[model samples]
Target chain A: MLSEAEIETLTGVAGLMIPASEAHGVPGADDSAIMSEIIVSAERTEDAVRNALAAFAEVGDSSFQQSHPDEAAVLQTIVASCYYRDARVLVSLGRKPQPPFPEGHEMEEGDFSLLDPVRARGEIWRKVD
Target chain B: MKTDPIDVLIVGAGASGAAVAWSLADTKMRIVCMDQGGTPDPTQFPANFMDWEERRNGPDHISPNIRKAPSDYPINDDGSPIKVVNYNGVGGGTVLFAGHFPRLHPSDFKVKTLDGVADDWPIDYQTLEPFFAINDRMMGVSGLPGDTAYPADRNNQMPPVPLGKSGEALAKGFNKLGWHWWPSDVAIATQPYDGRAQCINLGACLWGCAQGAKGSTDVTYWPHAKRAGVELWEHCRVSQILVGDDGMAEGVLYFDKDGVEHKAEAHVVIMAANGVGTPRLLLTSTSKQFPDGLANSSGLVGRNLMFHPYSFTEGVFDYPVDGARGPLKSIWSHEFYETDLDRDFVRGYMFEAARGRPPVNAALAGYEWGTLPWGEGHHDAFRKLNDRIMAFCAICEDLPELHNRVTLDPDQTDANGIPVPKVDYTLSENSKKMLEHSAARATDILNAAGATEVHAGYPIVYAGWHLLGTAKMGLDPETSVVNDWGRSHDVKNLFIVDGSVFVTSGGLNPTSTIQANALYVADQMKRRLANLFD
Candidate 1:
């Protein structure tokens, strides 16, 4: 599960990239956080994944980071990898993911099409983890 | 290569586009309606509330919206000035739009005459009365007409969507305040009009009504037009409206579903690509004869773009009102629907109430009163407030201003390398004042209805839902893009028959008016078809 700090950081980046002020409130920064969780948690039940993140954060409020302490480093690593990958992809589509893979697992190249502008808007949440 | 000529080329397949096709079906003209996306099916819509978000965002979630079917509609979203949020399909926005069909008041037409700010529409309500009646019957509007703020002559039979629980609660407040309220005249069938079934209170029209109740163009007019021999080219993106040397529309250049560029010559062209898309096509069609953009000699092709300003007001009751227990919304109030100069506003607003849904309700409640939905002590609070929270949203009237306009994005383009529509809009002081007045009035009504916790929405300065008046029609050729009959001044055979042709920003949702206006103008075009060969 992703950490709160990672979620907030990813949300901030998504917000900076796609401002709610610009998109008429459709894919705002907060929506980016939701989108990011949806993609990584696609294999898991949405509620279980969200609840797991909440447990990791140690807070009931989804956005608060102060409560969640243990899940910080892992979430940050995942988000940082995703963000770096996205930046690389921006320069050239379908770029390989950056090193520092989760638990030293070999990372594989993935389709960014899954992150369609409207759907993968939440992918920014991957930036903080 | 020679291109086949079409008698009529309709550029969009949304509500207005589909309506015009149906209106002109009896004319026996070879009509070709082109949309940028594929056609949607209503049968695949998700009905369960729990699974709605999955259906709404996931690829498998079949949209109940009568829009272009999904193929490979590509949109470019980089750091671009143009922020385009639109769906191109057979039914366009009508597929996604929350169908709250309320007719424009007579005062909506003569805004300048009544309040002296925006320009007046060339055609008044009386002029469009017959077409409105015709449109209502065709769409099967369900409501008690006499209860509306500005009631019209009962010229057509109405559908039977009886007042739901949410409507009853909202009506109580309006009745207590002695304000004019009514059941919202929606396109949903109440008693199974035509072949569709009655609305079983699905409460998810935005996603798509699987009950076959909501009257989408695909269900109502598209089939009718098809039966009448209207040729519809789904997944055809109309890029330009070509004008001949004789100052008449010649044809349209568009790309097929597979990205193959093709030209379809037409005797007349009708651009119904909505307010944003319609204006962009006209502005982008710059040629040697009209360098400033086709039909833009008046320099008002994309100017005066107006979107209705919306403000949501919520109320929390003592017991569980079970707000999210019925069809989205069945009741509305037009009590403060007037251009009251005393309120220091140029236009009016309509108040509509709906049962606040879960996530949104929780987020809003938390945002307004700093209450958390999750935690040990929050379950009771959630049950107490969730069902108790009902909303009264004010759809504020925003008159069209020339400075508030839509232009082609100088920075970004879509998949076909066409610049997306860029909207440069800001709320006027008059609009602000009108929202304040509406909000204050809504608060008063909510309080009267015994709401314990009331939260009013913030002032909207940059809302974009009720789009209208990008290519307005007027009697003066110099001041307007199209004539009163919706024929373009620059290109005689080109017509702008959508919300873009609206002269004034009416104080109502522009869909019904757009549909009605298109029907009226297509009828006029039907009479002028003989001039094509001559």
Candidate 2:
């Protein structure tokens, strides 16, 4: 539902939200395909969304990105929600890209020994008077 | 909805309805159940695990308004902050529940006697104890055998599910605070029982269990109840209850999948619909004998709607807490379960370890609560928050106020052309005070557990899981709708056996108690078969 120009604007805005970190190997929202994924979740019509993006993108690159907090927040939330859906992003964050069920993640059992400390002190339940 | 002449006709095949059918399996009575929702399609649920993003954001979202499937009847919850959370399928809300099975304490039944707020339940915990034991065994409960925090009982069938990193951290905080912390008793089996498989720890119990590990009634009770000769009709919407000229329930009139009207004549009619649904069904069933709606002589059909108000607080740790592996609610604290004169509120709240949302949910939650700020630093901020956070949800006890209620919306109707339910609810000052207190305490516990940051939010729209106290049980016909055994006071053959009969919404989860009440009421019905109407 996004025009090429609006996609460019969204790409610019997404970078501002979570800029590409070369040091950490994290892709920016634009290059990482988060804006495309965000388009999949857009509830608004293409004309309305494009028009909204036009005002922000026209304001001299980073002008509206810094100035319009409402649009910035709206775009940031959408992009971030979609950004986590990317398997590459998930792996970089040390998370599995797969869905949580059917084949569930295998977690290492916690130090069950840590519970002994609490148990050693005896029961802590207050008596019913 | 058309069926043979039935000895007992139950309106819902949910947690309560399925339990009642199973409990009465040995009686060899001709029982049939009518449900608006079909059995959950595990293949289409989060179980199939594809379209995870769209399903979580759209079709499989917890609220029926978003899911908007054919089986779900739309509810106008525009008037309330906590939107209704329910599923229409055979298992009912249990299909989407977290399986956090905590029983009500003895004090929960005596809220009015102890704290002078709300009416005391006609029946007490002592009266429901045996039924609770029965339900625990039937549902395959898992927990430590003798939790000192509760009345000593071996009702727990299996050892507690292993406490993950989040559980260990939260347990430390509770130990440090010297409060009562125990592994929560959940309905999900850790080991195979009664022909069901052990839990594979699939993260989305609320999204429909694919492995049949989680104890949604369709997988648990309905299978056995059906084997015991109880017929379940899916896509059967009961539009009204027919009352005979003698002021007794005759049968139910319902609509089928093709909008064809059908009838099931029965001697006894049981309403196992949830708190909101049970009353809405009754309010729509107006007859010459019950012009004001059947079994509503007390004028309490849909009044006193109580959903446990909740607050969520997440703690950020330097280390990873991959809580997404096991059941969502494995550990909890009853530290604030009792009333204290020092607090401004009459009752208390519970602190449960909330875990295991996907990355999308976690990101949305972090941003919604303002822990993860937007702009250039957002990625790093979410990085610090994502899988490294442990959450604590304070489930507050809601008092029954006469003004808070569910009523029929004149402007809205479902696909079957029945008027839908409209909720009018606002959090009470007592609950608000309790939430503030509970949130602060939760933050303290998280901080003590060595968190770098703690985030808290009030009145999120998704906290409407526990539906209770609409058609409640009591001793007087003038004051309450149902009597001690969940039989309607005005109509002898009519009964309500669900969370709808709850006198008060306790701080803990209500499903176990809902099932326990169903079992007790069914047993009472069996004993009184000779003179059920007397």
Best by DockQ: 2
- Considering the two chains of model 2, state its CAPRI-style docking category: acceptable
Candidate 2 per-residue lDDT, tens place, B159-207, comes to 6776888888888887788777778898888889777777777777778
* Candidate 1 local lDDT, B1-534, one digit each (tens): 224568888998888999998998888878889888777766556443323433443443232121223443332323222233345677776665666787777777776776677777888887788888888888778765444345447433454354544456666676666666656777877676887777666556666666666777777788788899898888888788887777677888898767788888887788888888888899889888988889998999989887787777878788655444455666676657765556676567788776665433343354336453222333334445655777778887777788878788887666677776667877688777877777788888888778887888745432355568888899887899999889888787788888898877666677888898999898877777767333
Best by lDDT: 2
Find the candidate with the highest TM-score and give its number.
2
Candidate 2 chain B least-lDDT 10 residues: B49-58
Each candidate's interface RMSD (Å, one decimal) is 23.9, 3.5
Off by over 4 Å in 2: A1-8, A31-36, A43-74, A108-129, B1-3, B50-54, B369-376
DockQ of each: 0.02, 0.42
Docking tier of model 1: it is: incorrect
Worst ten in a row by lDDT for model 1 chain B: B60-69
Stretches of candidate 1 off by over 4 Å are A1-129, B1-4, B46-49, B54-86, B359-369, B459-463, B531-534
